[model samples]
Target: DLLTLDVDHLVVVTHGFTAGLLVAAWIGMPVASAGHVAFPVPSGSITTLREDGFFHNRAVVTVGDVAHLVGVSGS
Candidate 1:
């Protein structure tokens, strides 16, 4: 599977009406991730692993943060 295509800034976006979001949060890779919704928090700030069970949320540099999901949306 191309899921491990080997790239930087891997993102996975899921519609507000799907379970994809939960799955993504459960398993994040690399070192950055976030959650986005249509209303209130249109986009979640980038979060990075911080100290002891903490992560720093910041701005996302690219939509690639998970647009790839759109391609497999129907599946």
Candidate 2:
């Protein structure tokens, strides 16, 4: 249902491991393939997921980006 949402943008707040699974799912990667892989999602980090107009182009624009946390404590 999430993939068919009509919103122009959406945000999902979840645990690190869950977020990793989401990333893997978005990219069509098998869950079994993630066993040995690591998707580090640091606290206060941002991951950008994109779907372009009409064509339904999907992609992970950025992953675990903490640039906004720069100069902040414990970042």
Candidate 3:
């Protein structure tokens, strides 16, 4: 049922900052410039981007989703 969806959108969330951005760039997607933020995205972090089309625009929905670790320790 998780694979069933009625909406037309694409979501990409992957590890490796450069690799993710590079793949998106290669596909002609507009990507924001990477910055040296004070807090870097930790390991196991999630970076999500959503779009309606594959070869068009995509917007970030959420980054670093740790909700799955709500009741888990050392998350």
Model 1: per-residue Cα lDDT over 14-40, one tens digit each: 454333343444345222443453122
Candidate that beats the other on lDDT, 1 or 2, i.e. the better one:
2
Model 1 alpha-carbon miss at residue 11, Å = 2.0
Q: For model 2, how many clashes? A: 0
> Per-residue lDDT for 10-71 in model 2, tens only?
88887858778888888878878966566788877899999878797788899899999999
Worst 10 residues of 3 by lDDT: 31-40
Cα RMSD of predicted structure 1: 11.2
- lDDT per prediction? 0.36, 0.83, 0.53
User: What order do candidates take by TM-score, descending?
Assistant: 2, 3, 1
Model 3, 1-75: lDDT tens per residue? 422566565454555566455445534555453232222355666656565466756555565666766777777
Best by TM-score: 2
Error of 1 at 21 (Å): 5.1
- As a TM-score, model 2 comes out at 0.81
- In candidate 3 the C-alpha lDDT for residue 3 amounts to 28
Between 2 and 3, whose TM-score is larger? 2
Question: Which is better, 1 or 3, measured by lDDT?
Answer: 3
